[model samples]
Target: MEQERDFTELSMMSKTRWNDNELRYFQHALSQLLPYVNPEGLTILHEINKEMQNRD
Candidate 1:
């Protein structure tokens, strides 16, 4: 199986800006994978959730 890259690092290194839908998609996807993610990935998911909450 292909190894999964760290989502947080990928986000930090990317220059592309995320739209609302894209962010929602990522949040949903990450939430579904939370159970399998490492501690850092979990932290990233929480950070994403917090940002989403602040936007609301």
Candidate 2:
């Protein structure tokens, strides 16, 4: 269960810094996650890493 959440959360993070090419990949990856997560929830999870990093 924890591992699943970690993997899902990792997918969310990948979207944060995506460029054009990366965005395509991010979207592709995220499509797989959408069935399990909503856009608003994903946005919160997505920003977690970035927000943590900025604090350092």
Candidate 3:
């Protein structure tokens, strides 16, 4: 869980640094990769998505 959270935070930071097109590509890659992740990781990703949405 800790590793997953760390990864999510890192990914979020990277995403924030991206321009619109780069962010879209990042999100697309993340969506494709998510199916292979564990449930807990998925949950963390979902939470992160929610936070991002709230920020917007």
Relative to the true structure, how large is the alpha-carbon lDDT of every model? Answer: 0.67, 0.51, 0.55
lDDT of 1 by residue, 1-56 (tens): 54444546458743244445555777899899888989977876777677677668
| Candidate 3, 1-56: lDDT as tens digits | 22223344455564344344444444565678896978966765565565566557
Query: Sorted by TM-score, highest first, which candidate order results?
Result: 1, 3, 2
Selected candidate, larger TM-score, 1 vs 3:
1
Candidate 1 colliding pairs: none
TM-score of each: 0.65, 0.34, 0.46
lDDT of 2 by residue, 1-56 (tens): 22223344555554444334444444456556777878875775456445445545
Model 3 weakest 10-residue run by lDDT: 1-10
Per-prediction CA RMSD (Å) = 6.8, 9.3, 8.2
Evaluated against the true structure, the overall lDDT of model 3 is 0.55
**Model 2 TM-score relative to the real fold:** 0.34
